[model samples]
Target: MPLPEKEAWPALIALCIGFFMILLDQTIVAVSTPALQTDMGASYNEVIWVTSVYLLTFAVPLLVTGRLGDKYGPKKVYAVGMIVFTLSSLACGLAPDMLTLIIARGVQGLGAALLTPQTMATINRIFSFERRGAALGVWGSTAGLASLAGPILGGIITENWGWQWVFYINVPIGVICVLAVLKYVPNFPPHTRPLDPLSIILSVCAVFFLVFAFQEGEDAGWAPWIWIMMAGSVVLFAWFVYQQRRAERAGNDPLVPLAIFRIKNFSLGNICIVAMGFTVAGTPLPIMMYFQQVHDMNPMHAGLMMVPQALMAFVLSPYVGKLVDRSKPGKLAAAGFATTSVSIVLLAITMMFDLGLVSALVAMTLLGIGNSFVWAPNSTSTMRDLPHQYMGAGSGVFNTTRQLGSVIGAAAIGAVMQVRLSAGDPGHAFGQALLLAAAVLLVGVVASMMADDGTRDPS
Candidate 1:
């Protein structure tokens, strides 16, 4: 049965607020680096760690956290996560040194890992197939808005209120989320699967090693050690997969149940998310650098240009949501990825030649419009067919895949940008970087074309 709208919509709203804040943390710190370095007397490398460590820690536990929601209740885990996140945010804001800030930020990441999966799982659990597209649309819109808003908000807060405000901003929002969660969010039935600690440990290490190698590879001059670690990550992950499958056959609870992948859309959906993550994490580097370094725009001005992108997402998403409810998600998702791909390619072409800022804005707005279609539909397609009991496992895998994609994308794009910069003109390098990102996005289009089995909403 569909949830009573009275209860469902309010809970989604509360959850979105917290979800928005958590995702915002991904990009917000980029604008605050200078302020933080000067204030804390941290070396440049240490300041970089402030962001990197957070990313590393945030990505590590997602698979486990998703299952945690299943074993416990979503409301309980979500409530606890908020408290941990809020207190850590407080610690981050008041930190005496870089060391303290990084530690607090890592803790914040842990809280985030706990909180992320419940969002999708809860949406999947509460909404019916016909209605799920709309709920996911809101979730997708929040994500789109957060990506654009993080930079703008960060610039404003960092300039006027100091860097601490970025962390401090989470405090009131967190408190409100906790209270809203308690008041509105339902307690989902527990999955009752025994916790799999070995799988959890392996998954965490696999993610951590892969991310560490990719993020630090170029910085460390692509050293042998990084390669070895990367190889070790792959081997460890292979073993983890083997163990999960063996556990499944043995009737033991696996960290990430392989059965979740038996659903068609869910499997392909993951491939698309990883590709999107590459572009989402990849796009801003060249554009932001082009804005500030090429055009000499300040951080705030550079950030303002992204507003049009978010504007498109905000305006177009409701209609897209309706379409997602009615149409085959594969078609909408394919179109979205295609449009997004074209937008980025055009942006690279126009920017590489220094065509005009107006052209770049137009391109990004189109990209944002395309962004409107991709997230919700893919999310809907992935989780809609899964059994209710599997929502936590499904949500965790989905989100973890997305998070891992983001980490990989950031590292890959950074390496490519550095290589291109060393070889030729900055503008040309930026364009090449974006071209690579667009190619990655195109992979999503191809994967999406093969999604949505025509089982729920017909083609």
Candidate 2:
């Protein structure tokens, strides 16, 4: 049964709580990196793994988790994921050492993987097609707001209470989400389908190697083993793709539907989202470090720097959502990418040149504005045209690319900073790292430009 208008909003609100928490964890650790390093007596590489491992676990299982939503009921899977997340969060808050925290975070990521797809898939199932753009706009905006808000919130919590509170805070939010979901969110009929284990193994191994190679490359002196691992990741991923095609043809339920890529907007949107993910994930660590470590700002002050970007996104997302339904999403996305890339470039220049806090604030404000344009339009355009049968699969693929971009960004930026740190200038090293994210955003610009721009009427 389709959800009535009155019921849908409540359900979406309930779902967004869980969704927000998932995205929140993605970058929340950024502001706490220094704290974690000091408290746990860990090196930079190990501290970076705290974020990377979460992203790695989160990304690898997403393809299957979406299928789990299709096979089981979304509601059941979502509820279970929430339980896992809440408990792991508790474990994270109490961890005795860095290794324990990283392990707990990996479990937390698994819960995130299970929870993410159901929100999108449920929104698709419940809302009428005419209203999906607006619903998804709200969804997309929640994603943007959560991601951008992470550093701000993390700083505040870490500074006042302790870094442990960052994870501890999720406990209450998770409990509320699980309860609300059980009360408000309805379960759709399940599609009983078989999953391929080989494909799952291949994908997990492929991503693990690729990210691991990047994470360790600089410290390992770009060793032959790193290059070999990189090559092996490519081979494994290529094999995984080949197997997916064969599975689809053989009537064995494939992890991702290859036919979905034929939707030009969907494919292009995925590419753009990858860049979006990459930039968002890649920038936070270096930027946060610059503010606190180099500039001698307290954690609270460092977090306050993100306020402009968060405010702009919060204020502008509703209007952008409307625009996405009424205007050319492709153009909006292109403009957004161009604007974001410029903002990052400005930030990089400011840091590299010691241009001061005012310049950085201006860049952050611009970044928020740019985010408001990208998140809603890109997500709406990408999934709006997908067939109902592929809704779960489509959501899975979309999120996978987004998170995969994050994983890559996290590793690549860390590596870049590690290498550049040898130059003996903290500002220069971090600023150079920011440029990589800026460069990647331009790919989003080009992808958005090439995308189909046909607007769909709300009626």
Candidate 3:
């Protein structure tokens, strides 16, 4: 029984409430890190763990959690995750010490991991094919808008209500989201097949090692242990792949179906998102720093500079989503990537030349426009043709790549900033870093060009 579009919208709104919070937390804590250190009297390394630990826990369990959504119903899994995230957010608010806060954040990350894939998986199952792009466009907009709002909200909340409120804010949102989901979201049947424990183990360990290496590599100065972890992750991942192949040969379902990659759009979509994650996570810090460090803006003022970017993305996403259903998604996505790349170049120029805030605002407006074109189209094209049985796994793989891209982007951009800052003025250093982000978007452009049109016959 396919859900009616009216009902599906409510479910999607419910799912996106949690979705928005998950992404918001990912970046919300960035501006609060310094405040945390001061209040808790924690060392710089300890404060860094506040964010790093969350990413570590969040990135590691995605494969398992995605499968869990398939095994138990997504509704049940989502409810559990909401409870965990809400409780952990409370714990985070009340923590008397940095250690407790870090632990709580890790639990929150685990909760985030559990909630993420089910949204996409559920949408795929619920919506008729013809309208999926519009649904996803809304989802994509939620994702992009939440990210842009994080720093702004963090700055406002941390300054006015204190840093703890950042965590406290999620409690109400989480509660409402959970109730809405249980009421509106359909109870989709679970896949009752037993999961292979070894596959779960290998996937978890492999992702943990890989994510941790990148998360801490720059901080650890690329030490031998980091390199060892990276190598070990590769080897374990290879073994996991081999195991999945063996499972397929034995007629058993694997954690991630090996066949999903055969879909050209799916493969290309993963490639494009990795680049998108890299650009989204990597580009912001330098520009934010340029605003604060070079122009002497406060955190609030610096965060406010992103208004044009957020506004454009929010305004244009729905229309662009309609276009995805009507046009070649690949071409649309490629145009988006190109537009974003050009915007980054413009931002870089604005920074390097000290071209003032007007030009920078112009660049951001273009960026928002580019983002509007990318998310809905790229995601719709990627998963539109995926099989029902594989929806959870596909969503998991899709999300995993995006998160991995974030980890990679954060590490890479940090390194670039470090090297550039040491060699030149803040303007030049930040400008060069923006250039790297611009360069990475070109890869997305190339990948998007290879995607399918994403059109499907009416169900």
Colliding pairs, model 2: none
Candidate 1 stretches with Cα past 4 Å from truth are: 457-459
Error of 3 at 67 (Å): 1.5
For model 3 the local lDDT of residue 388 reads 79
TM-score of 1: 0.97
Per-residue lDDT over 38-146 for candidate 2, one digit per residue giving the tens place of the 0 to 100 score: 9889988788789777877788788788878887888899999999999999999999988899899899989998999989888877887667667777876787688
lDDT (0 to 1) per candidate: 0.85, 0.85, 0.89
Q: Model 1, 232-300: lDDT tens per residue?
A: 999999999888987777766898878778888889999999988888877887888988888899888
**What is the C-alpha local distance difference test score of candidate 2?**
0.85
**Candidate with best lDDT:** 3
Question: Of models 2 and 3, which has the larger TM-score?
Answer: 3
Q: Is candidate 2 or candidate 3 better by lDDT?
A: 3
